[model samples]
Target: MRSSPRLFQYACRITLFTRQNCSLCVNAKQVLSTVWDKHPFVYKEIDVMTPDAKGWQDLYEFDVPVIHIAKTEHGLERPELSAKAQKLMHRFSAEQVMEKMDIISDPKS
Candidate 1:
């Protein structure tokens, strides 16, 4: 799991579930990189193909390039995040991610 140290635990955490040699995963990664550079959130990339990543692989075996945006200021995920923490599947765009990020940063949204 790779991340940016600058982003504290309280910040929004973006988790990207991906695998090797997948065109969609590569494309997702590129888009995520663009979003990350623009927003500078706590980003993490997990390769589902890894031996220890079996958990994620099991859930997303057929669905690669899954993204989860979690906002946990206390390091505890709130299931009530209607928009704060959202899962993005398949192909997505930076604009879509930015929208989600906006909601995460603004609780009133």
Candidate 2:
């Protein structure tokens, strides 16, 4: 039987805000690719340079690969993915990084 994604161990949504031909953004995407391949999560790339994306300019103008996570009302006491991933892998063999990605992509929030 197929299980609901919401019931998974952990789920993270990684969103990358970048511009065209930005070297740092390229590197960040590469890193995220590796991370995705190693985990069970979803990722999205956004070009804030686009006119329609101006709304995000104020918060992440300089931070191209800004990451955010969803919380369980507690507001994510500590939203450090790398550290949390490491700890999880140490305890379980599955060690799915994607399952732990608690990111938000919509700039409206």
Candidate 3:
């Protein structure tokens, strides 16, 4: 079966869910700050303490450095990012990033 190239080409949207006073979250923020500037994509952090951020508390109380991708349709529950999210951040888009890295893909396989 032939697959649509556009679907394969879709860039992943990463939404970093975090809270105050979390060491991991702090570290994640620092890494994102340094790298995202080059990628040219927005990374937002939501504090679980805020009233508006209540919805995040259940899933993130123990896991403070949860990263949610917008691709999930049924909210930010399942399919949460793994520990390797740090490494994956480097896979950001080169077309928009300051330092461009050639991304090669084979459609015919």
Q: Which residue segments of model 3 deviate by more than 4 Å?
A: 1-12, 71-109
- Whichever of 1 and 2 has more lDDT, that candidate is 1
Q: Which residue pairs in candidate 1 collide?
A: none
The number of the candidate with the highest TM-score is 1
Clashing pairs in 2: 10-99, 11-99, 11-101, 12-101, 12-102, 13-103, 40-98, 41-98, 69-102
lDDT of 1 by residue, 32-78 (tens): 88987888777778887899777677777789888888764536333
Q: Candidate 3 on 1-109: residue-level lDDT in tens? A: 9866564453334566677777777666666566556543334566666787766666566676655443222234332433323222322332322222112122221
CA lDDT scores, all candidates in order: 0.75, 0.48, 0.47
Model 1, position 5, has a per-residue lDDT of 47
Winner on TM-score between 1 and 2 is 1
Off by over 4 Å in 1: 1-10, 72-85
Q: Model 1 — which ten-residue stretch has the worst lDDT?
A: 74-83
> Pairing residues by index, what is the TM-score of model 1?
0.74
Candidate 2 C-alpha lDDT tens digits along 23-95: 7766666666677676545555667677766765655567665443343222322323333322221121222
Clash counts for all predictions: 0, 9, 0
TM-scores for all candidates: the values are 0.74, 0.55, 0.50
How far is 94's C-alpha from truth in model 3 (Å)?
A: 14
Candidate 2, RMSD to the unseen true structure: 9.8
Residue 94 shift from truth in candidate 1, angstroms: 0.5
